[model samples]
Target: MRVAKQFTPEVLLSAPRRGPAVPSPDGSLILYTQSAHSFDDNKTLKEVRLMAVESGASEQLADDDKVHDAQWIPGTRTDIIYLKSGDKGTTQIWIADGADPAKDHYVAAEYDAPISALKVKALADGSVAFVVAGLVGPDGGLFNDKTDEKKSTGRIFDDYHVRVWNELYKAQKYALWYSTLINAHGKWGVAGELQNAIRGTTLEAPYGMYDVADPGDSFDISEKGITFIAEDTAPSSPEYSGISHVYYVPLTSFTAAPTVRPRAIVMGISETKAFYANVRFSPDGSKIAFLHSSYDSPSDVRLYMGHTSSFGAYDVHRMIFGKRPRLPPKAFEFAGDSDSLLITTEDCGRVKLSHLELRHDAEATSLVESGVVTAFYPLQEGNYERLLVTSNNIVDSSLWQIVDVSMTTQARVISSATKHGAKYGLSHGMVSEFWYEGVNDAVVHSFIIKPSNFDETKKYPWILLPHGGPVSSWLDSWSTRWNMALWAQQGYVLVAPNIAGSTGYGVDFTARIYRQWGGAPYQDLVNLMEYLKPLPYLDHSRAIVAGASYGGYMVSWMFGQDMIKKFACAIWHDGIFNLPVFMLQSDATGGGPEFGGAPFLWSNGEEMEKWNPARPELLRNWKHAPPTLIIHSEKDYRCPITEGLAAFNTLQAQGVKSRFLTFSDECHWVLNPENSMIWHQTVFEWVEKHIGGKEARNF
Candidate 1:
């Protein structure tokens, strides 16, 4: 058996960690960001660095504390363009040339206006085109003026809308402005502001363009206008509750008049809403690539490529991956030329990359088999490169290597970090695979992890860690802060089972647990315990069930079921105790409606009644609950704190030991550093108390 190296959090997040390794137009150098974890400060920092691919030598370009995205200045061989903070919190354009760090110049530094959103485009001529958002007042200025007035009035607010309305009322009025930078003359052109247009009594502001490029300082090409996909509440019929439509505005004409009208590209009168949009153009700007999906199910995104000349038209020549009955497409990159693209598809637990040629009715050639391709980039004109690849076999950490098309290549340093002093050493961990028969001889796949220093002769307590998404899969990654790792560090074995519904394998596998709830999947857990009870190193009597969100639902369900007496405690974080109540109180107020507003409620009233632990009648009769700890956040609209409180109160009424903790300033997930530390501390202490004892720390 071969052991793979271990990676530190710093290495996993290092800048240019996941995105495209975009080289300069001239290809003299390649720029990428490496994200590194600062253990001292407990924060991540992104450092932009330039590498001469020919020499393999790299140097740090600039270190802006808040810098995120960076790009090179087109037509300039020695200079790079980046955004930096000016006065207040406003970001302005800064130019750095050669290796000189201090000898940098700022374009339009005297304007004192903020650049809310910016992009640099290299054009046919040796100039750069950019956009800036300017507003009246100080650096951190906003658009509306009534916001500060409302805030000064000092009124208590209970909802997010009221708070946002007050802030908008105080914001300073602003508009989108455009300008150009001439590298030949080293000067910025006069700025142009956008004008507003009114449609049906509602005024609209310019949202800006996707790409901007300057040509010889005097002329510029700003293409790919802003398009918004939003849900339309007004419908023609009761059945057609709402529709999702795309609205676009050209950058050049947006500020002049209301001549341009938005054309609807995709029209669907349903309950589905667009969550996010990723738009990309071919190298020659002749075609565009877009990924669209619903917020409720983001994994269902479908990729489409369209021609640039045909506005609001989707090219039928393009292929749709998720439209078929299969796993959703993970990611794709255009390679070889504008005509060819590389598509990566993942289903259930396997990932495959293929070369997709647009010409000749979309032909595809497979590059690899079932495995996770962590990162990839274009290595040559026709061949794409793979940076890191890992297999489904959890025993091995992902191996980082440079693989070219037509052949395979291997490299060292697969894991991000080795021992600090040792030049290169492998990281150690165990990955176990087992199948437990559940509900009619159906096998459920599961993964287990023992402590780093596992002793087969000694017995170890078990922590059952359930994933948040009921339909999501538990992938093998070097996850440092995963709950399983936290417990494994404390001398507890971790068990994560795919059960019947978890994703990765296929749609059928995921759909099985949809309405099952506390059914087949729950039985899988029982079977797992039964399978593990006889193991020499396993302490069947000492077990804990813990999960968040849907997993939380399972944890609470476990306490209610008369399955096994081996578990000592359970931990629920923002879990759903009752399905009917969850649907009613959640931010999604219209019930679990489908695409056509058809309610996809639970299977039957009996299922709903049986699963809804929060029902008034059920709460009154409840007696046997577990020693449970419930944690919830005040701002979690998904699984609201109300649900947590209801469960806690019901458990207490039944004489079951239960505790509830509410975080005031957190959302569904904790974000604040200090608050996060406190939350983790509390969680570990609870685990220690229930799981018997803790192991000695190695460091």
Candidate 2:
């Protein structure tokens, strides 16, 4: 028998991660970026790789430390573009031929300023158009920091739009620059001048509140034009009203700007009340698709599609509507023809792929139902008859497969890392789930994770993990931040509940948390505890509850109610303590309608006051609060650090045993590998101190 390696925080953090796979135009090869963190070196290593579909063999294309965002140029085989440091140490566009690198592998273009979020499209006339995000000065031109220097260290803001997320507003703002790739004497290079798409406009693409720039998710380019999302700057204060609209700019001449201003693609919803995301253009350029979630009905996200003409006019219609049981639209892509599409939805506990016809009443049928689909690519070579997919489960990290368009056939696993789980003593048998009667006669779902070692006779303590988002759910998938298996390794059973407000169930169930944060969701959690009471294998007295974001908010809510006495201890990360104050400080802008907006302007006001955990009525229960650990990051603008500080101060003032942990360098989540290790160790030690799970900290 062989001894298996212990799955520690280091092992979990350092595991290799594959970025979204991009299939080649001909579907003969697939391109993706692979990265892994190394605690020994205190750095992350990355490589761009290409895998042949027929052979399951992959080869490294680029491994330079500077390489980032590698993308395939449309309409070409093996021709790629990526970002890397130029001669002046500024990020620039670099290109190479994967099949014949020796013939062409060099710098293709260099803008004076650093740029990122590259998107490329090949035009009908053999010309290539590309867009990149870079900092722009007040004049709407590329900002040259050396030339347009700001000497003042002092800052001033006259409005609520002072800062966004972690970054304080500076003189320059992020803007998208568009230019064409010109071929001169058998050599390719970007045009001499770059046109600012939103020139003279106060709008922003990939919006300020978005921590990362995912151009692909927010924008798409077709031969006729480009469509993108930009926040409406007409509002007096961006911090109070968060709404974005999709805009289309026709592209007839690469050298000249469009005659008309970027036309907003109307989705038939109020401009000030709708939230749009995941805008995409079909491969044939005949249709467009995007998701719309209204502020009035915040939880219900509908998929809408529109036909496009040559001049960018849209005949938009609601393609899919109504309360769906297994629907949580993540992303969609047009298949075979403009008549069919592929969508990924969160079903039950899993993120499953579904096939949908373009008609309004067409129902989606599950195509890949077993595991969570992380990413998918539709092969154009087969008229969209095949798909390249990447999926994972609770025990497995990465599983890549090739599936047919028809629902009758089983998917073929082209490449998988499932066997790698055995190296860490992980098996599928360790994971299980059950459904129970919850609050409001709803059937709530919960996933159960057990220790890898076999021993059903002994009773074990369990941990309750309520997921964040209030809108999100605990999917049956692998996660590095909150690894269920690794948590179970601490000699305790782990139960993750997809409560009332969670997605994947149905629209009504998801909308239950709105304006009643501590109502039905709380009752549902209590119901789960009641359901778990009779289990012979679980010790209810030694129970622990832990959550982050909205989950953290629930912890604070639990502190106010009589439920605090049931747990040995608790952990809350970036939770909302004072609801009204959070509306004022959060980047989400007035907490939207989820907290119930006032009939008259500028405030969440008294509507949010009722649900506040720090209200005078609820404060009386803090004295009896369980010994707890509160963690907050300085850069968490979504749930500002002030919320955590307020909770900690109130708990301490109430004489409750508690400790506060702060990470100044981290954002919403502790993503740095070193910081993650410290976080895991601290959390593990705290849990052990209260619940007597001493063997949990194997590291």
Candidate 3:
């Protein structure tokens, strides 16, 4: 029997796929982002594509190079709107409503400033409202204002200065400014900067940005109005108190700023109790639903139902009765009815769809059981009940499928957008789930990727991967960064365990590592390896451990421990070596809670050594540490360069064989294609050198 070739970094990374399938208003057509890699330019070329639902056909939208937030102009499949760069990198919204390929209905409108954020709502009256984020340039720009407000000389900072990730530090505030397409006299004019802000916000509560993993436009729209959540915090202060209030304002009465600034419905007395977000208006726009977490993390997010009388006050009701979901609330789409929603969330190790029925008052039910649903894009209900969804398990990458909303049968394939696996002759690596009891009888789940051509007769090196987050989970999905298939291609079995601190488990399970970062979770990894040591197919002597971010912190701590020496080598990227330096240097928005309390020291004023890997308490463990490889970038503000530098120096001073890999341009992630290639190639070479295996062929 012959074995098929498995995936490599280049093969997996260059796969062509339609990004985030978005169905049209009438559900006839679907549009999505398409990206292709350019070897000459060393960049990814992005374009918008439209797909016909009936026939699996696709056509690329021309004249779009760097499209952002491209969505079908609601109500019609003919029109599409997206943001792109103009002169000097200033983004403006462009519209394409075309019936011909050669002659396109293209319009590019500028409001005289860089469009930092934009959201378009297709109104029933044939006009569309645009919520844009600009720095409020000179002469009031658009919206018909004539005020010559003098420009401030320089940015004045009292406390927080010079840095806020994503947002620039400046005097002019970034507010959600409204604009409209005015064709009253058969001419389109960019309007609505002078019109009062639909929902004005300060710098602290970034109106247009996302602190979590979400799309660009933070607000969602329906036929009736819009809904968004913002917290009231000091504008210049660099802190998030996690206090958010949901607001709903109608399109007609949004003439002035703060047209309706209502207080939070049933807000807790303590500001730090909960953080609210993912607000949505039901299909009919009569009901609203939003998610809130007791803590800043996504563990305890719960769905709260409410009713709003046409953008007036909201009577919010918390859902009381359903089996509590294992993960946070996500993928909220009204199920064509007033009572149900089509949503998907993390369950065990996959993101699966669920039908939530909001009962009369307090009770709710999970109508459908969760399954292997990677992603879901809600579509308008046709005669047949269906939706555009991306479904996959550990053995397959997610591809677009039209699943029955009724769940009566298997899903039908809608499109084959990703073809790189076939193009490069890549075979699917086998995957399976493993479970073990860890620290206090808690059941920890893990996913394993066996070698492409697996046989029980041969033993293989093990690659134990610890996920970062400390609050995130390892979901069953395709990844370009850490390719599981690529590792398996190198004849190594990949083991990724969702340890105690990982999300998807309940809130208490996630919070168990609050001040015990180096305690139980570390034991879970070691215990998992111990349980697997008896397996005939695993070569524990040649095993290696690797991680990034909090995973990096774990690796660094493991490197500092002499008692738990189970592996031959260790690797960490952007790890937190010194918690004290981490808290002060990194721009992690929320601070202090992970350490159990605020910054504290003994009477001598020494830094807190509880969770700091760089403390003297853990210094002796690195005396005979395994061959270590440290990877970090200089611009990584989230974890800071100081961490890697300190760890590398400590390893060298302690006489441990180590190598330090540094990148000048990358921030938290190595996103550039060429840089990514170098990252994979070098890291694998280091692993092979230490583990006594020959390097695998690079693509």
Candidate 4:
């Protein structure tokens, strides 16, 4: 029971912290991207780096101002193909061969029209196929040239007449050109113009199979072509808002005619309640894996695989299906040359690695029981014999290397990394799981992290940090630099709860928080505090509730409810204040009928009225609002700046200690390194002022 070296904030913030450590096909090299910030430039860039797997010698590839979507072309002499931000805000493809950085070449030129290339797959024939978008001019630019010519002529006429005809001709020319670009590259790109392009069938529908309006998810490319999962928002079934369907475009057809239409492969009706998770294709291009669940079934995400060729027919006989035992499947890998896969599942109590195999009848069998397999990776080019596994027992994010293949197997830890009892002393914190009965007696899962220097004899301040996606959960993993680790270093304990609406457990557990929003989920936060009040080491009198987005909404709601008097302060980042204003002011991109509808608000108007923090009357009724910090980005289109501004203003008007911080250029998530550092510094300083003593400042 000897403890190993603890992971520190510096180590966690270092390069190669997270993501797929996917090796090149040859296994001679490994390609991965790291998020780095240039102190001189003040920008955040994802730099692609290559590492020699055997020697562990690594070097940087081309540093395209911003690099993302990295893929290796499969062949004898493979090259890395990636997307680079080009001039005029376009993303062009660039290819690099060998380890020579200067030899990198840009494949496509910057197009006058907006274009995006997605999911590049190198074909056996030495050609790459990808999903691309060609944006046309605004308002069906068919009349653009004519209108420009007329505008020029009118300007000349106005110069001669001075004030007589300039105003009249200017208005007319502007109106004439107002007709947006209806067609681009022979494809209909506009939404409203019907005659410009065929609507339902002829012209590509906006919410068809290939178009993924949200950029958070990734698409897959196969030898057959490129496939993407997108939400089908056609008005025929308005209730099927978040419903996602698969679409495929043949490589040959796409190459022959770049404007070729994408074919719908698999379609499903989501009933406007569920979330369409990630879609991954099998190595053989014969099967597709995906997760699907709704609000009522939050914790349960059913993992299903289907034959690629047979779209609607999800024959379980040809694929494998399993219910993920944890809250979220962090990462998964298919075993090399075997009908099995390695999955990483995190529950509130612990993180587990599971070895799942597809039986002869395609049934999934779990190996290593529940807590044995903690983290796993299947060895390549061999039988399913060895795996890279990491495990934990509440206080450690232990990293281990396991050499095991079957269930009745013995695992030896090749290397060990722990959070305490090392040469350098313990620098990491422990993750503990706790659960309590929530709304409807539903079991709510959560994790608490005590600081590295935690002492059982001393009472420490606490911070309740909730995740953004009411569906997202906090797991047993190392902390990130952006995570509230700075607070922990200042002697504060952090609590992340899965509550009722988190994924990975089961569908029913996840769906409990649906439109109920301000009800059960908020109650769960208070319940967690009540459960933790008696803990000997926790200082319940100096607690603070904070979070971003949905978590921010929870903080705002908690402040209004007077739930916890011990809260000295609260921080709300990009949170929602008024659901109605949020619904009205927000764009049509993320929030639609699928998420929570405007009409549904009318049905539950009382709940909306009672919960919305933006209501002036509600703000006036606040008797004991905590000292609050409102942080938001002006350019944030997701939660919008108005929400944060309203909350800050209301708190200030009520003579409560509150301040507003806005990042002018940042989005919902701060990507700039300077701003991120400043944000962390501010939070750390705030926590230290309220909770940290001189001893806590000694790091």
TM-score of each: 0.73, 0.93, 0.87, 0.74
In candidate 3, how many clashes are counted? 1
1-699 per-residue lDDT for model 2 (tens digits) = 242477778888888777766788788788888889998899988888888878978888888877887887776666788888554436778878767645557787776776777788788788788877777876666766544545787877766655566766655667777888866675668876777776766678755334553656788878877777777655655534656777777776766776656777665544446677788887787667777777677666776666665323222224344333445587777675777778888888888887887665677777798769988887654356778888888877888888887856888777766463686789888989899999889999899999999488878888999899888899888888899998887688999999988888888888888877888889999999999998888988789999999999999889899988899989989898987677667766644557665422345556666778888888889888888899999998889999999999988999988999999998788988889998998998888888874564667
RMSD for each of the candidates: 7.1, 2.9, 4.4, 9.8
Using lDDT, give the best candidate's number: 2
Local accuracy of candidate 1 as per-residue lDDT tens digits, 313-391: 4432334332345454566656746766766666434466667676644445666553355455543322354322323
Mind giving the per-residue lDDT tens digits that candidate 4 earns over 1-699? Answer: 442243333333332332344445555565665565555565556567776656657777755546666766554344666666555455545566645555635453333322333344445555444444332344532222322333244344422111210021122111100011122342212222212121123222222222223232335656664445545433343223345555554444323432344565553443335544555667776766655554334344445565656665242222343332334454455675326666656544345666666664343344433332334544333345655454533323344444576656776544333323242244434446677777687778876777767788998888888777666666544444335444564567888888867765664666666666777788787687778878898777677788898888877777667674668778889998887667545432233322354423555465556657666665665557777778988877668889999888878878887778889888677755567666765665565566544343431
Give the better candidate number (3 or 4) by TM-score.
Answer: 3
Q: Which candidate's TM-score is highest?
A: 2
Model 2: which ten-residue window has the lowest total lDDT? 310-319
Task: Give the whole-model CA lDDT for all candidates, comma-separated.
Answer: 0.53, 0.77, 0.65, 0.54
Model 1, position 218, has a per-residue lDDT of: 13
Per model, how many backbone clashes are there? 21, 0, 1, 26
The model with the greater TM-score, 1 or 2, is 2
Error in Å for residue 149 of model 4 = 16
Query: What's the CA error at residue 310 for candidate 4, in Å?
Result: 5.3
